[model samples]
Target: MPRARNTGSRSPARGAGPGRAGTPGRGQGTPAGRGQGTPAGRGQGAPADRGQGARGRGPIAGPSNDGQQQQARAPRRRRFRPGTRALMEIRKFQKSTKLLLRKLPFARVVREVCQDVGGVDFRWQAYAIMALQEAAEAFLVGLMEDANLIALHAKRVTIMPKDVQLARRIRGPEKGFASL
Candidate 1:
């Protein structure tokens, strides 16, 4: 087996040692470790270089990790409790308001509420939530229209609790949302 030239111990001087014809020897006429007369920084015969540029690191590679370590994750926030939850802030946009219920993170809160009610395997699906949101909006709009009419018949513009109650009764106990 041919041995790799013992370049480790050689001092970088121009034109020193038995030179490889192409790679200029350290301190040999190569201009301070410049490979093939290009530049000194191209990892020619630089004593400290290990040719890291040829094959780069893996995905998620960092200076601290050299493929021997797993990346550490940041700790998760504590579980939601009523008192602690009150301090947290959540942003909601005006457009989503028409498509969503007030103060409700429907999907996550649906799962939590279902779990509280002892539901077995309650997984929240996006399409199901979206459909339910639309259905609720439709039901509410129709109900509010009927309630407003009842309030108007009573010579009031503002819909009262009694107006909604009477509207539900008029819509009846069998097919109405009162049964729901």
Candidate 2:
């Protein structure tokens, strides 16, 4: 066992009453309660006795322009989906009065689509490709418009598969979108 240190003098724990002896028992804390050496939160002005909230500071203000304070604006977000941007560009092209450009799918995609859907088409014809391209463009336009409306209704910026499915239902009865 270790022996207590001897300094030729002894004192009660700091802030303990003069009548109390030895250090305070475990978890008993100071005789007066939680705020040992400081005053308890009895009133708003108790800080004077507790020694807190003494720092003198003023409200922080950012840099100003002239006499008018400038408000920060949120940065605009750019859409990432290739489909949305392409559709927007297509709409812009359609609205232009100066030039009318016919945007059709590349021959490779058309051939692949044919082989997958049409099948047994060993020989490709120009008229057949043109018809398929037009139909595909029409289906895409209706699908995107419907799906965009659905997403907007849900207060979301992203188009989900469910939105596309809903769009398909809307376009199911339409003549041009019958294939969809």
Candidate 3:
């Protein structure tokens, strides 16, 4: 036979429950230490009225209908590190900038290379593509800058293949620049 459980009934007495008598959860009704009908700030242990509780309207006024503090709460902490968030924002801006600049010439080739490589996870594939695109863009910008300098040195307004070849030669194998 199964034994019946004790399911005790609650009493309304001041010392009825788990906590100390004056504090909350000991019993129902208003908390034990507070006085009835006296305006707030006049109660036991309340801070002296800093001119706000005279009309019973501001910070010095005791706990309102609910028991929370009237002052503004502290700001919540971020779940991620500040640097990680900043980097994510920078990545978003970079992606937007790439879209505004028109499609990259080597994006298709990068995607093909990623596809041909084995053991590439889909999650890291986008990151890998972005990294490659950034490296390519930076390299092209540097090369163009150097080529423009060479063209200017030769007293020409336009950059020619020779200027680019000279820039590549100057960069050399040590810098990973290939001959045109």
Each candidate's TM vs. the true structure?
0.39, 0.39, 0.37
Q: Cα RMSD for candidate 2?
A: 18.1
Top candidate by lDDT: 3
lDDT-based ranking: 3, 1, 2
Off by over 4 Å in 1: 1-104, 116-118
> Candidate 3's residue-wise lDDT over 1-180, tens digit each?
664432343235432355544223214544443322233434432343232543335565345765454345666887996579977976786676553233445666665666789546333466666777677777876888899999999999689999988988999976536745
Candidate 1 residue-wise lDDT, 102-123, digit = tens: 4357666667777889867576
Candidate 2 wrong stretches, greater than 4 Å: 1-91, 96-105, 116-121, 173-180
TM-score comparison, 1 vs 3, better candidate: 1
Order candidates by TM-score, high to low. Answer: 1, 2, 3
RMSD of each: 18.9, 18.1, 20.6
| Model 3 residue 180 lDDT score | 53
Of 2 and 3, which scores higher on TM-score? 2
Compared with the true structure, what per-residue lDDT tens digits does model 2 show for residues 24-109? 33355333222333223343322323433222132135454544323355556876776888878878867965322253445677
Which candidate should be chosen as best, given TM-score against the real structure?
1
lDDT comparing candidate 2 with the true structure: 0.56
State each model's CA lDDT, in order: 0.57, 0.56, 0.59
